[model samples]
Target: MGSNIVFSANNNEEVMVLPVVPEIEVNKPQNNEQFETLNNGTINLIGDEGLRTFSIASIFPSQKYSWLKHGSVAEPFKYVDFFNKWRAKKVPLRVVTSRPDGREWFNMPCVIDSFTFKQLRNGDIEYTLDMAEYRFIGGV
Candidate 1:
C-alpha cells in the first residue's frame, strides 16, 4: 500500500512537487431530480447529474527549503507567482492522488476554480485549492 501522498504541478518543463501533503476532499456528482404529480398519483421524474468538485488544504512555509522528493529548494514567494500563472492561464492540469491501500486516483483536465491564501499568527502560510473536473466539448 502506498504511504505518502505527493502533489506535483507542471508549470513548464519542471514539475514542482508540493512540499506538504494536504487533506483532499472529493465530492461525487449528485443526481438532480424533479418529480411531477400525475392524475393517477404517480410521479414522473426529470433531471440529470451534476458535476464533481474537489478541495485541498495545506500549508506552504514562507521560507526557502528543499523538498526531499525532488531534492530541489523552493521559495515561498515563488508560489504566489505559480498560483497566479495557473489561475490566469485557465489551463487544465493533471492531479494525481495515491491512497493508503495502493490505490491511485487521477484527475486530469482539471482547472483551478479558486485559490486562497491565508497567513497565520505563527508566521506560516496556508493555501486552499478548490478545483472542478473539466469536461471538454470535444475531447481532452
Candidate 2:
C-alpha cells in the first residue's frame, strides 16, 4: 500500500512524500514461560528481509533498472541516515534482525555506530553495543 507521508521543516514548509511503512503483526506466544521483560529504554529493531525486499521492489518494479534508477539506489542508505537523525533527536536504537550469521559485514560503520546491532548468530540473537559509548540527550 502507498501513503501520503508528510515531513515538516523548521522553515514552516511541509513536504509531501511517499514512505513505505510495512505493517507486520505477530502474535506472541501465550505461554508465560516464553515471555521476556523488555526494559523501557529498549527499542527492538527487527529487519524483515522479506518486507524490505517487497518494499524495495514495490518502489522500483523494473528489474532492468536495478540500482541505476535515480532514488532507488540511494533509498536503502536512508535507513542509516535515519539512525543518525534519530540519535540526534535522543531516541535509543536497538537492532533485531532475522538475518543469518555473518551478514553483519554489509553494514557501514557510520550507521553501525548509532545502534546496538543484534542478529542471529549460530541460532541465537547476539548484541553489540559499541554505539552506546556516547551519551544520549535523554536517559537512554
Candidate 3:
C-alpha cells in the first residue's frame, strides 16, 4: 500500500491556521496485555483489556510561499503556537493513512504525548509529534 498519510485537527473550525505537515508517519494501535506466572510453571493471562495506543510523527519543511504575500518564514512559529494550544487543551487528533492497495486506516481519539521542533542549517524547520491513542476509532 502507498505510505501517504494526512493529519487534520478534529476541531478545524476552532483552529484557523493549522500547521502544514507534509510528511507523516503513523504507527498502528496495539493491545495492552498482562500475564502472570503461576507457581506450577503455568502462565496465567491477566488484565488484557485496556486502551490501545499509537504514535504519529510529522515533518514540516521550510519553504517560501506566495500565500503570505511576502516571502515569509513564520510557518514554524505558527506551528509552535498550534502545537502548544493543542497540548495545553489536551485535545484529540485524527489521522488518515492511505495504503497502496487502495485501503485507508483511520485512527482517532489520539492524544499528544510530545512535540519536538528542530531547526536546520538551511532554515528548514522539522516538527515531530508523538501521540498515543486513547481509544480505538476503527479503520475503514
Indicate which candidate wins on TM-score.
1
For candidate 2, the TM-score is 0.23
Q: What lDDT is obtained when candidate 3 is compared to the true structure?
A: 0.54
lDDT of each: 0.62, 0.28, 0.54
Report how far off residue 127 is in candidate 2 (Å). Answer: 18
Per residue, candidate 3 scores C-alpha lDDT tens digits across 84-119 of: 786687666665555546477554556778888888
Task: Show model 2 residue runs off by greater than 4 Å.
Answer: 1-77, 99-130, 133-140
Q: Which stretches in model 1 have alpha-carbon errors above 4 Å?
A: 1-14, 39-49, 63-73, 119-123
Error of 3 at 133 (Å): 0.7
The digit string of per-residue lDDT tens for model 2 on 9-85 reads 22223221213212322222222223335665544445333211111112312132332323222233343345446
Question: By the TM-score metric, which is better: model 1 or model 3?
Answer: 1
Pick the lDDT winner.
1
- State the lDDT of candidate 1 residue by residue for 3-22, as single tens digits: 23343455344344565656
- The candidate 2 region of ten consecutive residues with least summed lDDT is 51-60
